[model samples]
Target: YTEDEGFVYLNSIMDLYSRKIIAWTLSKTLEVEEVLKCLETAKRRRKTVNPVVIQSDRGVHYTSQKYKELTKGMIRSYSRKGNPWDNACIESYHAVIKREWLNRFRIKNYYQAYQLVFEYLEGFYNTVRIHSHCEYLSPDSYEKKYILEQTN
Candidate 1:
């Protein structure tokens, strides 16, 4: 979220395991409702989801009253101040997203960027992109393998 092009807000929830962008929402403003909607989207998609420990920077959106009220008891929140390493996992994902997808393209508008981001996350990153942590398997494949191993 930046003021580069008339108020852009990018909110995303990422899994640390395979660096998967589980859910995200891009909006024209940093409204609490928009943030809530993104969280709801993540919740709906996950079956047998674990209660998460969400770590983020001390951004206004993450520290807002609405977020605290909405997500109370559902997830434990942690914030980092002036240290990028505190949220290293998601920071790494962000770096990759920007370097590989967002930075390469000329996004004429917010909607176009939104669509491109969504497609990259679902179609490429989660499904096909190999990660070092998973020994070169994509997030989805790594998750499946982990579940299989756990059940066995």
Candidate 2:
């Protein structure tokens, strides 16, 4: 989500437990719809039955009334101003994604960036890449293990 000619805004939601990118969207504008889509996608993908708390930066979209309504059932939290530590998990993930993957490619347009991001998230990052925080398991694997453990 750079301001370059070919880049677009990337709104993403991460799960701290598995260090996974649960949901995301790439758009030409930083409209509230972008983050809302990400939030809804995360809930659906996770099959979230209970209220979940979300921690975000003090961005305009996060503070908007529409967003508050959309997340009405859930507890919304904000990171402290000028404190990256308050949102360290997601901030670190963003840095990792840029350094380990996105920086290697030369994106030609927003469409290409979107496709590339989708592939990286779905095909590689979620399924293949192991994370140290998740006991050296990939995010999907970590979640699967939890399910298996519960069923056993």
Candidate 3:
């Protein structure tokens, strides 16, 4: 939430294998279009030829026709209603970001929120912050190690 924007929504797509946030969009509205944009961004960023499985909460945006159409070929996994643990990985990320970084600032507006998010995600979380799930390597470094292992 921001002082000027009231409440903003962050739509993000995380790669489960690497626990990496492949794409994200911060929007003033909770419209499905914003979620779709995030999905499109993920598609462009990953560019995988293999089938993908996307897991998301059973939100209206994820249930929308546009979202289903966009992810036609991909497998969609929805968490059981009221079961947050099913999507705990991403939920934990949201909580961690707020507790670690966003909660430290007095965000005045959407721009400030976006900037803070960008810095935390791009500068620290993906590049520098270590994760036990990634064998104590940062998300980017973990992914690079995986790619290198695959090639050799």
State each model's CA lDDT, in order.
Answer: 0.78, 0.86, 0.92
- TM-score of model 1 vs. true structure: 0.84
Listed in order, each prediction's TM-score against the native is 0.84, 0.92, 0.98
Itemize residue pairs with steric clashes in candidate 1: none
Best by TM-score: 3
- Which sequence of candidate numbers ranks them by lDDT, best first? 3, 2, 1
Q: Which ten residues in a row have the lowest lDDT in candidate 1?
A: 1-10
Off by over 4 Å in 1: 1-7, 47-50
In model 2, which regions exceed 4 Å deviation?
1-6
Counting clashing residue pairs in each candidate, in order, gives 0, 0, 0
Tens digit per residue, CA lDDT, model 1, 21-133: 88888888768788778887876776445576666677776778877876665765565567678777777777788889887777777777788888888889899999898
Worst 10 residues of 2 by lDDT: 1-10
Please give the TM-score that candidate 3 achieves against the real structure. 0.98
lDDT of 1 at 117: 82
